[model samples]
Target: MSLVYAKNDWYAIAAADEMTLGQQRQTLLLGTPLTVTATDEGVVVRDDQGKTYPYQIKFDHVWTALGDAPRALFDIPEGDEPGRRCVPCGVVRVKCSPLRAVENFLDIAHFPFVHTDILGAEPHTEVEPYKVEIREEQDEVWATKVRFFQPKAAKSAGSGITTEYEYRVPAPTVAVLYKTCPPKPEAQDVIAIFVQPRGEEECDVWPWMALYDDESSFEELVQFQQEIFLQDRSILENQLPHRLPLDPKMEIPTRADMTSVAYRRWLKKRGALYGAMTEVA
Candidate 1:
């Protein structure tokens, strides 16, 4: 895939706690070297030549962009809801395209194979038809009515149960999953995946979750989310081509891949070529 980083959107670089007073951290996004530091005023971000860029602190992370941002960060209303545990499950670095990481998060077919009994089991390997669409008003891709059987849908689950899911792709490298919460049957557990494209072939993924469980400790909640994402890391790193192919002819899509297909179309429509492949001339 040819690399063409999207510069006009907010990308989460580091956890808020990672940047403390008098501390400085350096990272790369879309091949651009970035320097982050904490000052008396607030967090500051600059480029290699000391050119400062605009940034904001939200959802427990430092977000910045390389070019003019057309909009603010995507909102997660659940983050502000009382009694919900807003947990940040550290970052996981993978040697794959950021698009691939987001696609994997939107896929439930892999649950039976990659996630095993925790997310799915044999005999329930079938992925029932779901709805996928590009919302013109919001300019985002949405997948709804997705259902799956999970032995442990969340850390607070006591037994296996059927989990309903809704996936939203608001950006090229970001996706959020809303799934059934056993403890709070009326509400859904929100899991958001934010990918920072370190390069065309590599990325650092940050996982955040808002759960209704008050029974689990903070450490346990983080560990539970980490365990699930780490399992996906292995599978993502081993996929051939490294970059995601935007052309449908490059890979076959089945009923289960509706979300992924819609995502590729969304990216292509916006000319987002970062970590993406186009037809060779």
Candidate 2:
């Protein structure tokens, strides 16, 4: 019998800061050499020649990393129309690697299980699907818009948290995003975007930004969220064969694996699937 294995997460190779204009970097996306460049106009990426390409805009406070490379932040042109428009979204483009980790992490279905130490510790919790909107300009790499919502009774452990998670994945390395304003005045809200490698084994993380509009203090709220991610790293980094292999029956997933499973399905459909798909071999 033959079993095909895939990865459940995506690996980030470099950040915006590590790339230079007209320079090329090697990446592991589908075991392919993905090249990125910073140009006078913005950022352009090519695979195996001038074919399959897209250009991005450069702006201030923009940072990114690619496959074990250093991080780089760029300066945007003054009064530049395109640059100005692209800055708020935080990213102009991104390349979904073989891991499909980006979509997996965001799949609300797994929150209660995979994140048992954090969001999943409580009972009867689930993420409600909100909306997904996408827009791609002519000759653009890929532009995606996503929205997420949590109902009032969704978070049993924490207080009722309701807001939209918006994202614009402009490049394989950039994400522009923000959170919608909460209807209630006393609630806390955060708008943020994160681009990091699947695990410590990979390289740079893109510009990670967290913007807040609510009045609740940012101290504990930020720390709480940060700790959750850190916890994920601690566990994910220690697993055997950190990167996904093609053999399906190498590992075992327990009851807490629901989130991982759902995320895997999400990425497979997006064409960025990765990780070992096994039932405790």
Candidate 3:
């Protein structure tokens, strides 16, 4: 497994509301210990050696890069849409590679087995053919036209429906999913999963959502999202080899794994070795 992390990228280190003035918290990103402090100026992140790094507050989180950043954080224009609730679902720590966490977020074939009635159910386990591509203009991976049957697709969903989905990987450790919204059938609910690599085989995942829901309370929405991801945590931690394999030869990829394949290819092309195993014995 390659322990080299692509440092030239922004990673969500802490939720905005979690950081208070004059408070300091210790966290890890890309296996580097960091001291995060909230000040009048803004949130400041420092390495163990007391070297301060550049930081930005966006999407209700503090993002920082430990190396020379290639660009700023990816934009989510939908968050500013009218009548949408931007919910920060909080962080989930898992004993697995961050790359694995992001890949799992992009998967729909496991919905029936892992998420059950919430995201999928038995007898409707098929993952229809989807369009996967690498947009050279933005240098990101996108999977569209993905459809799947779900019993309770969202917190506002009143009945089972076939959810149309679009998955986007803007960064190595970040993935965004756009799925059908029950309340607003014309619009889609946005769920973004940002992972912080605490170690080569461990990470803390932050899930943020923007939904057009007027029925569910804030607490109810958070609980629903948390329950769904907690179920996934079990499967992620139990997977063999912990680190994700970048080589297709290391693990067979079926038709349903097209998104995963594209993701691996994107990572390999960019030479992202952190939390990636190029070969398996």
Report how far residue 254 has shifted in candidate 2, in Å: 15
Order the candidates by TM-score, highest first: 3, 1, 2
Best by lDDT: 3
Locate the minimum summed-lDDT window of 10 residues in model 3. 1-10
Query: Which digits, one per residue and each the tens of the lDDT, describe model 1 over residues 201-262?
Result: 89999999999999999999999889989999988999877778888888899889999999
Stretches > 4 Å off in candidate 2? 1-101, 113-121, 129-158, 166-168, 173-180, 183-201, 214-222, 238-241, 244-281
Model 3 lDDT per residue over 49-97, tens place: 8898999887888899887644667898998998999999998899999
RMSD from true fold, candidate 2: 10.3
Whose TM-score is higher: candidate 2's or candidate 3's? 3
Model 2 whole-model lDDT (C-alpha atoms):
0.37
Report per-prediction Cα RMSD to one decimal. Answer: 1.6, 10.3, 1.4
- For residue 210, model 2's alpha carbon misses the true position, in angstroms, by 4.6
